[model samples]
Structure formats: structure tokens, C-alpha cells
Target: MWGGNDSTFLQGNTNPVSGQVYTMYHGTSMEAAKKIRKEGFRQSVAGMLGRGVYLSRDLEKARRYPLNLQAYQRVVLKVEVNVGRVKKIDKQGHPLQNIWHDHGYDTAWCPPKCGMVPSGLEEDCLCIYWLIHKSLSLAGVIICRQTKHLQGCMG
Candidate 1:
């Protein structure tokens, strides 16, 4: 009962030997973004998916991060992730839930509405070193305030 029904679940890579590249979003404070832009991403000590850099493929989800911060104070970073050897943690208390990384998985994924996340949004935890490839450059920035539009870029 804990693993849930695989038949109704969306198709995903359950066991992968190689890595896959994906575009993901990471939301953080502008202050922290400055540091990340300099040093690079760091792995979290603990989380739903254990130790890794948490990200989401959903832009809206990324936009709502640092939950306590106002929209204007938050920075949504668009990142390209190289998730190597992914493990699907679709439900709570999964056998490999927290130790996927130790078992050779470079990334852990929780699909949207899988009942694992309270918000029902998809989430991913990737090993810090593999989270970014090449250079972390700012492509563009869009400020959405009610109706007005302002655009810019950092770095």
C-alpha cells in the first residue's frame, strides 16, 4: 500500500544507468542567489528527498518558493540539471526514500500529485555536484507586477 499503484502513475524513469539533462527551477532569495552565482549550488543536509539540491520542473512552483518571502524578494533561477541515475520516490516511506544517493542514485524525483508532497507539485533532489554543468549564467529575468512588465539579466 505504501508504494501505490504503478499502473495509474505517470511514466518516469524508475531505474536509469546513465544521466539525463533537464531544465529545472530553483527559487531562492536574491542575497543567496548572489552567492550561488559565485560558488555554485550546495547540497541540503536533509529534506523530503534527503540530501541534495531541491528543484522543480514547474516554473510556478519555483516562483512560490522561500514561502515566507514576498514575490519581489525572491529570485527564480532557471537551471539545467544533469540528473545522473534517477530514483523515483513516488510515495512516503519508500524503501530507498532517504538513502537513494548512498545506493548510487544521483537524483530522486517525486512526481506531481503523487501524495508525497503536501502541495501536490512535482519535486526533485539532485546531487550537488551533478546539479550544474558548464557555467551557471543568467539568461534573462522577467519582473511580473500585476500588469506591468520589466525585463533584465544578471551576470
Candidate 2:
């Protein structure tokens, strides 16, 4: 999962959330995570309006959330430039891990974007958005945009 400087640390081990008061894991896999969730760790903060993860389910109330429109525009332009380098593809035809360099996630990480695509559904097409990302240039930004226009855009 993508995180930021302001992210809160958890009490769990391995994962940051493990060390937090809410998450507890006994095993190394999903079973262990589930066990921890079932056990329920002690969290000082309880249920409240827009208090939990992602700052409440209400977008309107969370008016303080930050955004960078200029950065967004830059990324979009970068995507337009690199959308043609897509070589390999996945089952749904979305770009898979680039064959050359996959270090952008490590070297030039960007906050993950979602909600446009349905859960479990592949915006195999939207890889262009990331593939063209300037931070993921060269081996990372390799997508063919001309061939796929608005294929991933929902609205």
C-alpha cells in the first residue's frame, strides 16, 4: 500500500499497522491477520464520524484533505508521453510489470489512485496513467496511449 510522511504507525510487526493498538497478527499470512482482527487490539480511538482509516466515509465532511492539481496535470501529461511503450500485457491486457525496470515503486513512488475501477476489476487500460508517469520513466513508463483512449475513464 502507498503511504506518506503523515501516515500513522500501527502496533503490528512486519507491517506498520502491526505495531498499532488496533492491529495484531500471530501468523504470517491472511489467517494471522484475520486472527488479529478477531482478537481486536486496543485502540484509543473508537468509532466516530470520519475518524477511522481514510478519514471517514464522508468525502464532504473531510474538506481538509489535500490535493495538488498542478501535480495531477503533470502526471496526466507524462502519461500522454509514455503510453506507447507498453510491451508486455496481463490477462486482461493491462500492462504487467515492465520487463526493464520495476523500481519506480521503490525509487519514484506515487500515491496509489483508485475508485474509478470496480473492486477486483482491472483497469488494465488505465496502466497508461501509471505507465506514462514521468516518475516511472524509461522502463517504468511504457504504455501505448494512442491505441487506448478513454477506455479507462469512467466519467
Candidate 3:
């Protein structure tokens, strides 16, 4: 998600009474990044908050967890960028083998942001955010279960 140097990591906190740890990540970004993240989050949120959009139970679980604005924002932003990347990759008709790594868990093989560039470091962060979000979108379940591999926030 959109992780800033001062941002905090969203963790799965247990209620103590329930003894359940909710896994999450929290981070922040600039206005541009936030916009992008909002889009992605909207899509995933629909699936998680709305019923049967993506045929997933994540929404149900997400609904129960305490809201961490930063982490939730990051997840949304990541989804937006990821959807765009998948669209770009599909439009180019790139081979699945080439689009993804052979190991299946790696995303380094995905396409780069060919023409999109930011003006400065702030914008650059947004660009990177989009790229990473796109890759994660393509990964779907593979990336969802493993929060350890997630990047973006530095804080």
C-alpha cells in the first residue's frame, strides 16, 4: 500500500477477549497517491464491504476489524493501481509466463510503468505506488494471504 516514512504499519490486533489477530497494514501518501489508492480501495472495498462482488469473504472479515485509516487507505490505493496494471498488461497481450515470475510468488517479472512518470520525489512515490498496486492486483489471492511481502510504506 501507500507507505510513508512516518507512516505506521497496520497490524492485526487482537481484541484479547476474542483472541483473534487481524492482519493489516497502515501507511500514508500524497494527494495523488491517495486518489489512486481511493480508487483501488473502492473496488476492493466493494468486494469486502459489499456482498458477492468478487466472491470473497475478505469483506466480511474486513468489516469486523477495527478501522485503521492509514492501513485501509493503503490497501485501497494499492488495488486501484493494480487494476490499471492488469488492464495494461492484458491490452498488450503479454504472455502470462512473461507477465509473472516462474516461482508464482514473485512480481518482478511484471511490466514497468512504460510512459507514466512523476515530476519529483512526491510524484515519483505515487508512480511507484501505482506500479506496485497493479502488480499486487494481478497477484490477487497469492498476495492477499502473505502480508509479509507487501511493500510501499517506509515508516
**lDDT tens digits, residues 34-148, model 2?**
4434542122132111111111111121121223222112111111111222222222322423321242221111111322222221111212234233322111111111122
lDDT of 1 by residue, 1-155 (tens): 11222112223323322455555678888777778877778889999988888887776677777789877677777665556788888999999989998887788888878889898888888876555643233333323222237533232
How would you order the candidates by lDDT, starting with the best? 1, 3, 2
CA deviation > 4 Å runs, candidate 3: 1-22, 41-101, 106-155
For each candidate in turn, the TM-score is 0.76, 0.16, 0.17
Clashes of each: 0, 15, 13
| Pairwise TM-score winner, candidates 1 and 2 | 1
Best by lDDT: 1
Q: Between 1 and 3, whose TM-score is larger?
A: 1
lDDT of 3 by residue, 1-155 (tens): 33333222222121111111112221223443456444543222221112111211122233222234443333312221222211122112345423232323211111223322111100101123333433333212111121456633222
**Shift of residue 94 alpha carbon in model 2, Å:** 12
Count clashing pairs, candidate 3.
13
Identify the leading candidate in terms of TM-score. 1
Give per-residue lDDT, candidate 1, residue 138.
Answer: 38
Provide the lDDT at 90 for model 2. Answer: 26
